[model samples]
Target: MAGIGPAPILFNEFFQMFMRCMPPNGWPVNSKIAVGNSGGPDSTCLLFLLQKLLTDLRSKTMARQSIPTSVVSLSVNHNLQEASHSMAARSAANAAAMGIEHLTLDIPWGTPPFSDKPVASQSMEQVAREARYHVIFDGMARTGAHSVAFGHHADDQVETSLMRLARGTTELGAGGMRRCRRWGMGTGDVEGGLGWVGHHGLDRWIIRPLLDVRKDRILATCEEHQLDYVNDPTNFQPEITLRNAIRQMLTLQEEGKDMVLSLLIITQSALSGLPQHISGSLEKIKVAAADLQETTMDLEGGLHQLHGAVKVLSSRLEDVDNEVTFHLKNLTLPSPPSTLILSSHALPAIVDPTVRLALVLRVMRYVSFHPWGSLRADGNRRRTSIQRIIDTLWQSDGAPPFTAGGGVLWQPAIFSAKKRLRVGTQCLGRRLQLGERFAWMASRLPAVPYNMLDTAILPSKLDIDVTERLASATSRGDDFLEVLFDCRFLVRFDLSQIPEELVEALRKSQETGVNVRIKPHTKYYWPKVVLRKPSCVDIAYATLMDNGQIDTFGHAPWVTMKYIRLLDAT
Candidate 1:
């Protein structure tokens, strides 16, 4: 029996590891796919492996459900150097030779006018990454690809975790990149959600298929395949970017201390215990929330509410380790008044109007909520008291506004509501209406019952007239028609006018009542309603069935849905 060398053995081991961890349903069988190839060793190796795997699978009679693979290689020419374009051309040629689809996108390199500093000095690494992803996602959409895979190896993950640790990031950030996540494709900040902020329209499904593989294996694979790759010169410049510094440090560790293996071992150890650490911390926080009633509590106030029952829960920071206590301090009470409200307008205002303006702006950015209105809302006497403090601060040129990460504003009328608190933007529910034409078409579908169609499909079928009318009604009047479905088509009814109907539905569904959760002035509300049955089945079936006849939805004979809800602390 012949024994394979370290390189081949490592590659096979990593591939086996991936096979075991893969969703256990094989790769997505029928969706457009894009591969990010930067003419680098890692990506070249990945492309070769994917092509071989796809080809081999196609030859196997048992692999009837193998995805029809059409590989598209995307190269982003950052134009940082004159040779960038030539390198991209070489990559494109290589891809063409392999009979794989290829595209080269050229992006002009420069800092935005507002940030006129050199790219290197102005966090150029992050800036370039944003631009590169923007291009890749745009290409993915143009090709109508469902998933885009990248070649991020174990070394990259180590580097990322190290960087986050160095920067004193929160635990969530330090946890490193997720294996899979939803990508939104739009430019502006998504009004309701967070994560990967920037354009959402260019969003494409991104995956790191090589994350578990080592960089050495990648380089070895490239060598075995006789693939030529371009070395990025910017990576060598240590004066610029922390990544370069980290790479230099890692090189030093390898040469001087044999630290690479030790670091890897330590990282693996950390990874093994990370899940349990996170789980235990979250469980304790949940119990604390149940006892405190509020989702958040003031760190300074030492006040905690117990569920709907208000109670005082306090613990000294010295009792727990700094790492654990720091997180617990950030946790808010879990019930109503979810936000930790802080009042800061009482601070003395600067005497210089310019200074005062700057201070106000800085405060606004620092505090989770505005304090200016809080001062005005207090009765005449309290308002006078706040004004006096402002005048004194202004006259004395007091220190700049205090810095705090998260806190909510307090106003007289806003905080008066029992269950609701006024935050920045409150979202109003807008009822989606199916117009006369849509209703008529929906009522007359062939073979498919009118009620079987999802209400979500109305957006595509809605005519201009219906859209205009809905928009006008939502904008000008409080009452508007909405289509709701139970076993059948529920008639159009005003959202405010149908409280009784919604309550009755909730009762019949054997669930808790629904609540309209608002977010400041935003014109949308997330309705949290308990249903008689798990909505996941309905949602999953609706999505899977909507695409067409699902013979057996993918390789897995069964489907599973995982839901994780993050509370919004205003």
Candidate 2:
């Protein structure tokens, strides 16, 4: 056998490299794959390579005989320039040339563009990126795609690390991007219908196959294959973008030293000992010390409250004095109380109450109620309501609740417990009594699930009005009525035997009781309400109102009240 030269070998070096990195579990064989093609060198190279790889694998794999494979190419036209459409067209044409399915997505330029750079003056790169992904995900859903692939290279990773360093972000940011990680639905937006509505979490995936490869290699591959690519003129605008500056920096670094190798070493070093540190921290802390539910933290004296399960809660720095606070739900002390404060700058320590009180308050707001267990067991239905209420408070610029040793209390309207119970009973009876009205109301509500009345607690007249107002505003569906009758005194009644007219009359009387109970208390600023849901055991947030008894603010669409208590704080 004569030796063959590398030139005539027909080897796809990039494809081989990509395949080697696949997990032992292998690439999702049966998944409908999507590739993000920007008509640029890197993405174009990826599109062709993936298509060829899929075709070759299908032909070779005997085990995948029953598995069907479908591939689609997605091109995002950011509309940053007139050439965007042309670029998209070229991308589509290339995919067609490869005999693969293609789709072109056009994202209109955002107004004032959510970028640090001026819209007309420079590149709206960030805005364009956000818009581009939005379009890609939308396309992914429409086509029944299981995963979307991108062509981020090694050079991009180094640039990302440098940018995060400049901005004083956490070490996690320095990790660059993950090879594979779950995408965020963008904070609370994930809870809305817009959050992963059609997307499968575990089955559908996103892969970055070219992360380890260099830009030069990708460009070289495109050149060797004689693939035509479109160039964006904005990329040449050196004065406007950080990316251009970063590209220049990398070029300078390449000239000075082995930039890629150096970056690899630095990133590897920074990340090397992270796992050990995490494991050690976990071992030192008490298993039950940390709270995962409330997203708040608590500290007393020298005692440190650490969550075994970490929660990464973010708030505006200005809102909380440029510090990150965690709500330590169900946090218990691991050790003796020492005076120590965990600040934005210093390492956490144990100290006296005088020193720790301020620190604890900054990080965690201790509440009388711990709702995580209830919320988790019940599917977070009440938590949703609590979030809605918080949103209302923030929008209204109302103050958060104040806390002391007993529990945190909101200076809000205090409704009578008797009234709340009466209202709840009435709401529950409505379904038992007037099925027609319950059905009619439920249909009018937007997100209210079926069989809601079977599980929900009925609010008093005022509370019912609040629920109605919220539904009307957000178009959510009606709530069900479930009463947590006093366990101490169980009243026996056959719900099936109750007459509709009699039930209605009883409900009216209950409504009067509710009114009488609430009417006497007018000193508080908002109503102390408890929301109970099957998903949430017990959670509380305040509802704010103005002097005119108008619905001024503090309503949550996501949380349900479990119970409301009045405070004698005079």
Candidate 3:
């Protein structure tokens, strides 16, 4: 909004769209924003607009006042095409000409997707898209940016929606891409796959300001500004990709132009609003299902939203609502939710199957070790496994402990007759009788083996340091590091708390370049210091003693864990 006034008619509309698509709270005053610049028409236009916006913002602020808000263009060179490097250089040069800071992320040629030749494949676009996502996020991490903007326009949305519908998709998928979503492009099915270290505890946001704008308008902006841009040859080759084919079909049509425009309008008018409705329903269910009013705690030193206790309350069933009511024995709520309990009653009362599936998935995303963003694979097989779990939960017959996707362990919550009797008497307001059956208790599946298959699948260790993988991006001067462990817990380690002996050894190893590691402690007391190249990323050993053993909570108290909000589904 700072740059909207005194702008050309074209740019005013662009700025309005950008503001509308921003996060609810908008960006903080001193925050930095990163833009993905491909040197193409859309991205080029965005870069120019952002440059003008920054200039206006600087001029508006007092000369003595410091304006820390900045924008940087991140150009990623996939190296799959011959002109990739040149295009990246061109983009950098253009950004520098506009007085904008720029960074180039070059993907290695012999990476997994390019490990084989870059031949025509059905999935090559997806592979390239994922690679670009990784490169952009890596750039963001280095730049200390929590938000990244893209140049996906309305045309891209239409192509995407049509593609998904062609294959098969749910209502949400049919709605196409979101204007803003959780930054989760590179996260895969494996928990902590990318091994991202969070300097800021806030979740990453992806912004597409151009989603509502037409592609023609973007091209016109580029032309009006006399901007130079490149075109990816593969995009014009219809034989190479489905998107290209669809694009060619749409572009070559001279007769049905009105129909095409009408279709886009229909999509914008009708389908674009579906995600908001679904999100609202999910939020309603989540709020009604759990009571965290008294237990939500905000801690100091960047720690936030810690939950002390949570009570599952009863709610009236709606047309598309889950009727499950959970009553913990003796009126005592569950402590901090290591295991979550849900009742099986009235599941059939929920008329809509889509809502039912969505509710279960939402619960799984929360309770599982993998957060919502980490579950990238949404194939039929995964959904079928979840459906099977739902079916099992729906049945009254008691089943043994079962494991589902995202490492969520499900089993029946058992109670003695006395406990049930106490619940019946104490929770009479809920209108529940004694000796009633309670269904599923969901918990984080343990890393150790309950079976041989578990040994093969579960992570061998959770505390391993991935500092080397992210060494180039992390700050070297920080005495502590905040890690989003297992995508659920924000674990902060105070490296300054290590013993003097260990610190001396680490200092020595830093200069000598010797690999010196302390012996694994048998007790949960010692704070170990690891010295990686460039900086000290942290991995504090919290579980040195085995489970069920008595250990001092005061010992090695430098490490603290807090729960992070993971409901952002992008």
Candidate 4:
């Protein structure tokens, strides 16, 4: 409001539309958001806009006034350029003028906490991004903020899409930057499948309110308000980086025409198919899949539901506003997932061949951030690697067992007991250290990358320290300690003194054994996965219960000492 150059009505109209990216309605409480303030015109405008929005909301109604929202500006000093420190100082002064607290995070260079250390020849962009997100995560933790806001706008989207096309991207890559996403350690987010779900609101979202605005308007607003910001001279020199080149080229093209808008329209066109709503399609498929049976499940009926869900999902991946994620429940089958055994003699008359091919890509998209794994594939074209796999998946009768991104598996558990296809992450372990870093995920929250560290030592090497921490926290008389293990599960440890009644219940169960969903991922995937903890050995051994076909992905529970004993309790 102070520095915006547009007329009051024009500015109000534009700002209102921009706020739609991540509506304030979804938030249940007054949240403190951390802004990635670079002291640039875009971010500077964002900080000012948030300040105005919070103030305006406070004055609007009783409901809004009750919830107190504040902004904390964090300047990430990568130390890459000589002006980095000065930029941080500039941001701090601006934030102080607006009565918002400002913090500067210095980039750290070393081993364990950081990976992919920058080299001279390698691009510094990724390194700077890593350092920036590291500080952003640190800032979020220190300030107890739930959402981190960035300054990406409409023009950035144009550049991003073009850059992805230049780099040879898959379908997911071409979809452009997300407005809101959950990213971080818990719930396998950093490993894959749209990151974690942190209930405590320790950096769960990256919100972009300025996505609806264009760069020219943004600069105009800054000019009107008399706001001072630094320009990155490197952006003008396109040859320095691919992004810069694309950005410069787009600027030149848009000199006399609306090239950015045209590209975005074309991008939408490329997403293809009518935009599908996600209201009921996925639920229908999940309900049917959950009820699949070998003796009772009508094979034709089940495929019908599965195919429909895949179609709807594929159509809606373009609508980044709709959140899509997947999880698997550990269930036992009559045969190993590596083998395919179908009772159906022929393909269903109603389900077409095209549906089968689309299902593989669509289903893979549902569970993975990169379904095609950075490679372009077309069922109609010279077979790409993923296409070859998909082609095999829809063989004459049905495809054989196959594995893909993030240890994804396609197990045709099609015996008499279960006439359904069981798809889930394979048994390969993903060893992760709690305190280290799942760094790249900070900016792209929720839509996370798949690769995480795989430790070769004992499985406990990753979770042991987490165990100790939970133990220490539990000793402080915490009632129930809930913690996530390796982004796989959200596990809760029973720390309170065991009740005598429950002890008796355990004693009774000890006679027969009770089903336990001890691990966090298991609890998440197998809602009914209750295991019988009859002994320490059984408790330790309780896993996905694979038919000796798959191996554990080193995913284990992180619990306190008392809960470890509970694992032994039936």
lDDT of each: 0.40, 0.41, 0.53, 0.46
Give the winner by lDDT.
3
Model 2, 377-476: lDDT tens per residue? 1123233433333332223222333322222232221122232211112333232222111110000111123345324443332222222233232233
lDDT, residue 222, model 3: 77
**Against the true structure, whose TM-score is highest?**
3
Task: Tally clashing residue pairs in candidate 4.
Answer: 22
Clashes of each: 37, 53, 0, 22
Q: After superposition, how far is residue 550 of candidate 4 from its true place, in Å?
A: 22
Residue 68 displacement (Å), model 4:
7.0
Off by over 4 Å in 4: 1-11, 23-25, 62-68, 115-120, 184-203, 254-385, 388-396, 415-467, 475-480, 498-570
lDDT of 4 by residue, 509-532 (tens): 535554333332221121111233
Candidate 3 lDDT, 9-125, residue by residue in tens? 265676676666566456666677788998888888887886676566666745213322688899998778788888898889888888888999987646543344345566566
Q: Which portions of model 2 show Cα errors greater than 4 Å?
A: 1-29, 62-68, 110-123, 187-203, 255-570
**TM-score for every candidate vs. truth?**
0.46, 0.45, 0.65, 0.60
- Candidate 4 residue 481 C-alpha distance from true site, Å: 3.9
- Model 3 lDDT on a 0 to 1 scale: 0.53
lDDT of 1 at 95: 79
53-155 in candidate 1: lDDT tens per residue?
6666567776536453567888888776667787798778767767788988766444331122224443566566656766777677677776667777766
